[model samples]
Target: MDADETGRPARQLVVWRPDQVPAQHDVPGPGDLRDGTTTGRLLIRSLMRAQLGLSLMCLAVALTVTASFPVIAAMVPAVGRITVAGLPLTLVVLGFALYPVLFAVGWFYHRQARQLETRFTELVDPPRPEDPAAGRPGPDV
Candidate 1:
């Protein structure tokens, strides 16, 4: 059979090797985090501040939503008079509508908190670079 029909053809494989080694940088390592060096302490304080800011933001949103309900009822009396399924609209909002809003706030907070922690972890303990010589054929071959 022709090489084309057989779905096989001769081809040379090529290997790439780097001519120069990568330059090393003095990036913070896990030891720096554990040893509480000045850099490590600064990193920890920054993380704490970020988390605190996130928490305060979430709390502000929650409090605003909660407090606005009474103000809205008082300011717009028609809203309080409205009803659905034989239930007062305010009751419906308090019983069902507010839950989803609060839940969404909580979900957002959790997702953002996880992302912050993941970024911090990557900074402290970075993945190692693969060895250039590994799994390659030796020069003797």
Candidate 2:
């Protein structure tokens, strides 16, 4: 070890154990998520796939509901000619009836999407037990 003008050995500032082995295959933690480790990427990809599937399913339902009206009206010519409350049947169905169906689809999609996100958040950062001392009031003067 190098030393100052004096011939004494320099003091060691740091030390490491050569016998200690690094951790292997430990459970991924929040650090892994922030560090973008392999397991973190897999978890994220799974969540994205779930969200995408939900989106596609919702889109399919909305498209089917919207398209069915035209197909029904075409297949049954009498439906187009009918009137409801001084409005054409098509107008009543498209303007009034369709709104509820679309609204339900949208609501369902929103609820499911939120649930998926909540699940993902839970997976990434599982809830921890509250510290007993945290809630206790500190000693007063």
Candidate 3:
């Protein structure tokens, strides 16, 4: 502490020596997005493309499955007329099979979405080495 011209004690200044400070990489500032760098845009585009692709794949699968019913009915009239548990085969497939197929598609979509989110999180905010449990297995429940 040093005395000022007014005789009041001056605050102490703390300084860090060069060797005491950890080295740091050049991280982008908050203004990087407005600075027209393509990194942010590219990441957004990649994520959008992945989502679109997944949506298209699910759409294609749903279309194929739904269209198959009509195609099968037309190509093989006997299949539609066949009885299953006192109900027409077509009615049975339409009533029972569609729900399971839809449920499966929903489950697959949820899993894929979670995976995509995990990958995105890894890209945006990578795990830190200082974290003790980063890659460690948890105890059994």
Candidate 4:
């Protein structure tokens, strides 16, 4: 603390926590995997792993829907019909309900795949400096 020119005490600035480290990758984080730097290798791996996880999830949902198809079909004849939410029973159970959910899950995987490819392209294609005026060290050195 210091005395103000008017004689009032001036409170000193206090910092409790240290400054936060900068992000490792421009993408969302696994949190500064070493000195707050995200490398290309890590970026590729992260996107691939995430995309793979979504694929697996979609696959699992798809399998569940497929496996239940026979059971649903068997009940249709016995029950005569069962419409749901204003859709025909057969169409609702097989085409609209089951397949749509699977398609959505698959679409999520597809979107992730596109994002990974885009990011990978950015990692591979970067500006080069070969032109003399592009700032190479002169031969005069």
What is the per-residue lDDT of model 2 for residues 56-124, given as tens digits with 9 covering 90 to 100?
Answer: 999999999889888898999998999998899988887789899888998999888878876676666
Per-prediction TM-score, please?
0.67, 0.67, 0.64, 0.39
- In model 4, residue pairs whose N, Cα or C atoms come closer than 3 Å (at least 3 residues apart or on different chains), thus clashing, are none
Error of 1 at 53 (Å): 1.2
C-alpha lDDT of residue 39 in model 3: 62
Q: Record all residue pairs in model 1 with backbone atoms less than 3 Å apart, i.e. clashing.
A: none
Every model: Cα RMSD to truth: 12.8, 13.8, 11.2, 15.7
lDDT of 1 by residue, 21-97 (tens): 22223676555556667776778899999999999999999989988999999999998999999999988998899
Q: Which stretches of candidate 2 lie over 4 Å from their true place?
A: 1-25, 131-141
Task: Pick out the ten consecutive residues of candidate 3 with the lowest summed lDDT.
Answer: 23-32
Query: Which parts of model 3 have CA positions greater than 4 angstroms off?
Result: 1-36, 128-141
User: In candidate 3, which residue pairs get closer than 3 Å at backbone N, Cα or C atoms, i.e. clash?
Assistant: none
Residue 127 Cα positional deviation in candidate 1, in Å, after optimal superposition:
2.2
lDDT of 4 by residue, 78-122 (tens): 543666777767676666577677777777777766766555544
Q: Candidates' lDDT values, in order?
A: 0.74, 0.73, 0.67, 0.59
Better of 1 and 3 by TM-score: 1
Q: Residue 89's C-alpha lDDT in candidate 1?
A: 92
RMSD of 4: 15.7
